[model samples]
Target chain A: MQATPALTVEHLTKRFGGRVAVDDVSFTVAAGEVFGFLGPNGAGKTTTVRMLGTLISPTSGSAIVAGLPLSPANGVAIRQQIAVMPEAPGLYLRLTVTENLEFFAGLYRIRDRARIPAALEAVGLQGRATDLCGNLSKGLRQRVALARALLNDPAVLFLDEPTSGLDPVASREVHGLIDGLRERGVTVFLTTHRLEEAERLCDRVAILNTTLRTIGRTDDLRDRLFRKRLLVETRAPLTDPGSVFDGSPGVTGWEANGSGVYEIVVTDAKLAAPDVARALVAAGADVLSLAEQRHSLEDVYLELISEDVEATR
Target chain B: MSGERIRAVVQKELRDFRRNRFLVGTMAVLPLVFLVSPMITLLQIPASTPVSVIHHAVGGSSLLLFVVPAVIPPIMAAYSVIGERDQGTLEPFLTTPIEREELLLAKAIAVFLPSVTVAYGIYFAFALTIRFAAAHAVSAAVWHTPQIVAQLVFTPLIATWAVWVGIAMSVRARDVRVAQQLATLASLPAIGITALITFRVVTPSVRLAVALAVVLLVIDIRAWRFVSKLFDRERLITGSRAKPS
Candidate 1:
């Protein structure tokens, strides 16, 4: 049986006057999964997150966040169920880290005061709780925002550019914290422009450009939008690389570049690699290396965004 | 509205305000000067002047008391929403479960308490200076007249009016400086009305105080409603590019 999705957005749209910022975008994020929302600037990624976080009302369509319907009527309940770490850390600079967390705890009406210290500990800021937020580094301020979000123990967490502007070590620390949240079964809706971060952390990703151009498991998208290819390097140039790939069950096409290299399109590179190597050896060619050429998420993202831009133009 | 949420915002704002030395200095210094300067001038009045004229001069001094609440709250409240927006804290704050009413009321109360406290403090201090420093001429009866009634009753109403106006300006203005300037401009009418009473252009009477109080009370209700509407989540989040006319 399929578990009820943590969030389901159906044709969610937002318009600013005559301009439609988010145009009929739809997707679902299952419980405990990290769903990355990737888009360029002006692609309405922040607008969509604002709508889901109940900070702004959608101009049209509907959504269910953590099983609660998205509407002004359910806004308070929905807010209680979800927490958003906005693009800016947005901490109260004058207040201490502990004061900031405690203030939010009061807003969330968290009965147990112990949760403040626990949240601080969870974000690895136990020692800095008494330090003023303005005095902290940018990375530490981001972690303080994260700690504030967790005060509510929200069922769904929306992290927008969570690792943005952080040093490498700080970014890695945040990634590990997000990993811990996943292990604890908290659903995460991550919006980031960082393709590599999405590729590393997201179970599924949606590429949005005002509208959703594509949405699926990252690996599934890589496979569907890109071709799987095998590259072969040999000791000597092959006379007829087409003959070796021809009539092979999994091989779709083949091309021989000058020198000692050939590239072949395959349905599954893992299954077709051995066959291609065997064929080359039988044809009196010494194969030095055979490697699969997998497409990165960045390649898929750029291709989709450019295609959408061209189509719109 | 949840009291807990309102209290939370209020406490946090107060904590933040305490750390803002410039704001604290303005709130403190202005009221002290406004209250004490008049007292010094009134004390220097010649003893040869008629008792009725001294009485009138002391009555006019009560008008300076109105400035305490009027000036302080607008300065503090003007910074309430627009300042938070400039600091980037307003977005995260709006995302919380707290309602709009709770957040605005919290900010209003944060300014209201300090403004009223400082205003009343100056009032009593002014009264003491008259009692001890000018013991020969100015009688306590001057402090017990209709002007005193107006000061006691109408100061908070005007302060509340200033706060609501400041909050309204803060919601509409894009920046803190703009909010402060607009709030100060909006407050001119209240100060003008008080000035009329101070200069004897409009005499203070029980009926007049009650009438002004009633009018200000109605304006307060409307201002509160206007502020509540202006703080719509969509407008605030979008920076209100298309401001309501």
Candidate 2:
């Protein structure tokens, strides 16, 4: 059976003055998938995210979020099904955190006030429910925003720069909260400049610099950057380790150090690791640290964005 | 508007209004200083009015009447959209299932309720003072007219107009203070008319009052329709069009 899409954006276009913020962007996010949007500053990620959350309407394109059309005509309906945590803190500072939750839960029409405690618990803010939102630390404020979004038990979540200004520990807490949303089958659409964040949370990502430069699974991007290379070490010296692999396949970029430690770049290390191991044994070298090394998502992210500038230039 | 949706929206708006002690107190204070302070002086005039005393009293009274309707609403107008925008509650409130009007309805109530109520309260206190001034000496019809109007019809209508103009200013201006200034100016024309009438330039009569109220009502109708259009959630959020690079 085919999976249903949680979001469908087609030819999404938004203009600010004569500048195109988001131009002809089209993509579909499947239900329960964590879709990451990576971009440089001013790359229109927030604009796109805002449009999806129904906080703002598009100039001339269509979006279907949670199977409802996203437009001024149907904004209320679309908003009912989606949770949006904008980059900035959005809450009532005067009201205590619990009051803020109760106010929103009331808007969402949750009859009993008891449910607010549960919502607060989810964000680990139950203990601080009575504290004023304004006086809380930045991370606590972020969680309050998150808890407010989750009040409606939305079908899709749009979190824009959720961990942008957080300390490392706070960032981890927020990251964990976001990761926890997956268990409820909420479709999460996120935007971040941090490549590691995208790698850790997103199932797939699109690198956007003014427009999409490249998009795919993280490993697929890794492959485009470097060949599959594994490290193997042996005794002090080995002469011509590759001399045994006369019939081995796909070792195009071959380089082996003279310390009986060999490294051969292969397209697929699974097939090549065993062949290289057999050859190393034949060469009387004991195998050690036979681990595969891969390129980090950060390297791939930079490589993709810079390539766009180069191509445009 | 669906009943549940309206309630949901109203409950939230009222909740926010209740949460805002500063706005409530500020709304109450602006009118006290502007309207009640003047009304107290008007009630101080003797019933056996000296020619000079009546002239100054009547002139100031009419100006207060004009401003009572025009000026206070504009002040109230600042509280409409600017408060919501400044508070960062605009998007969340605007996106709810509640119809825009329901939200505005509550906001209208929020602005008008305090302005009109305080005006009436001041009128009530001023009325007792006027009655004391009359019983202690003499009473005149005009001396009590402003409070009666403030109580019966003029205050409510003025509050409505104030809220209407306020909604527009709040939507159009970038911030609450600016909106407050702009919306407060909505009463200028009323003040001008009162000035013309006060100088024996034009007599204040039933016909004049009705005509002026009719014109105001008509302008307010157009303003009502126009202000709702400005209440667009999209514009309030990203602001006006962005400059393209």
| Candidate 2 ranges beyond 4 A from true positions | A109-114, A233-237, A244-250, A256-263, A286-288, B2-25, B35-40, B50-59, B62-73, B133-139, B142-147, B191-218, B242-245
Give lDDT tens digits, candidate 2, residues B1-245: 54455455445555566667776676566656765665566666656667656655656664564455566667656766777778767766655555666666666765666566666776565556555653233235445453244235556666677778788888878878888887777646545644654544566565666676677668667766777777766678878742222
lDDT (Cα atoms) of all candidates against the true structure: 0.86, 0.72
Q: Write the per-residue lDDT of candidate 1 for residues B1-245, one digit (tens) a residue.
A: 89999999889988998999898899888988898787887888766778778767875687777877777888889899888888999888988999888888899999998888889888888887777777466645346577677777778888899999999888878888888888977876786666665556777688887887898889887888788988877777796443211
Instruction: Give the worst 10-residue stretch by lDDT in candidate 1 chain B.
Output: B236-245
Ten residues in sequence with the least summed lDDT for candidate 1 chain A: A240-249
Clashing pairs in 2: A16-B242, A17-B242, A19-B244, B73-B162, B74-B183, B77-B166
iRMS of each prediction in angstroms?
A: 3.5, 4.2
Best by lDDT: 1
Best by DockQ: 1
Chain B TM-score, all predictions listed: 0.90, 0.78
TM-score of chain A of each: 0.97, 0.91
Q: Against the true structure, what is model 1's DockQ?
A: 0.56
